[model samples]
Target: MKVPKRVYEGLEAVRSSGRTNMLIVSDVLRCARSMGYPETAQWIEDNRNPYWEGIFQGFSPSD
Candidate 1:
């Protein structure tokens, strides 16, 4: 599944902000799912950090 460049870039920006939490990540994933980007959502879910802060890093389509 191919994710749009804008969507991928937005996700990367959010992940790089250094202020994300699980709730924010969940909201992002939910939005992705709702916007017909299940693969992107799943990619986010798979790559999110396990810690409470900095919920995501190294956002990439090949990860």
Candidate 2:
């Protein structure tokens, strides 16, 4: 899926920082929401593994 430049860059940064999978997902969702990419945010939410609840824990995107 294609994401906004900032969201892509943010994910890259999160990866480069050696964040865990959950942290990476959280950051990407946060970026997508802050940038008005609700579809992207929802896609991430929908596509994520059900077992990884921590990935989206406490995150409620306004999108």
Candidate 3:
């Protein structure tokens, strides 16, 4: 997917933090499996943020 510059930068930061990208990816996929992130993505996307946090934000999508 074509993501924002800040998102790419954040992913770099996360990777540099000693956490494998797979770890984060797994978390997001796990959450996505239980409940899709379309709602959160839409909510956050609707209100654009200068900084884009990664997929997992501690709160999974309920619906």
Candidate 4:
């Protein structure tokens, strides 16, 4: 799924600020709901496998 730039930016912002996985997911879900994208929020909530991983793994700090 193609993520909107705003959503990507929001998640990136959260990560850059050192937010945890839970907070990042919460941010995404809240953003999606407030932006009238319940499907995206629900998809995030429902998909356990690679859900949080997919959202956050890309932003993991590299050593």
Candidate 5:
């Protein structure tokens, strides 16, 4: 799926911060909703990719 630039950037920021935990996702969700991007937040919430999980788990050093 093609994600909006803002959503992509937000997730990228999260990933870049090396924080892939649920809490960080939660923050993104909140921001997305407030920013009128609920779908973006929902998409992030729905995604359960191992890559993302790995990032969340601190498996990727540069994530």
Candidate 6:
């Protein structure tokens, strides 16, 4: 069976840019949302300003 075009495109992008940490990132984003973190999503992505790196340490970024 053939994969959908968007999935294929996503795979291609991952293939080229090696962003294997996407799953971890997505999970963190979900958790942030459930906790009512912020709006733009980018709102919680900051480490030096808003969200600290320590806050994200528990989330393993391993694939």
Best by lDDT: 5
Q: Which stretches of candidate 5 lie over 4 Å from their true place?
A: 1-23, 50-63
Error of 6 at 50 (Å): 11
List model 5 lDDT by residue over 5-52, tens digit each. Answer: 665655555545554454565775776676566665776667657436
Alpha-carbon RMSD to native, per candidate: 6.5, 9.2, 11.3, 6.6, 6.6, 13.4
lDDT, candidate 3, 1-63, per-residue tens: 335444344444444455354345544334433343344333334434322343334222222
Runs of candidate 6 with Cα error greater than 4 angstroms are 1-23, 44-63
The segments of candidate 2 whose C-alpha lies over 4 angstroms from its true place after superposition are: 1-23, 49-63
Per-residue C-alpha lDDT of model 4 across residues 1-63, encoded as one tens digit per residue: 334454445445544555355445777677666656566567567764555565545433222
Candidate 4: residue 31 lDDT (0-100): 64
Q: Lowest lDDT 10-mer window, candidate 2?
A: 54-63
State the lDDT of candidate 2 residue by residue for 1-63, as single tens digits: 344454444444444455345346676677656656666567567757631452344322222
Q: What is the lDDT of candidate 1?
A: 0.53
Q: Identify the candidate with maximal TM-score.
A: 4
TM per candidate = 0.45, 0.41, 0.32, 0.46, 0.45, 0.28
Candidate 6 has an lDDT of 0.39
Pairs in steric clash, model 4:
none
Clashes of each: 0, 0, 0, 0, 0, 0
Report the C-alpha lDDT of model 6 over 1-63, residue by residue, as the tens digit: 123343333333433455344446565555445444434234435433333342334222222
Candidate 6 weakest ten by summed lDDT: 54-63
Clashes by residue pair, model 1: none
Clashing pairs in 3: none
Model 3 alpha-carbon drift over 4 Å, by segment: 21-63
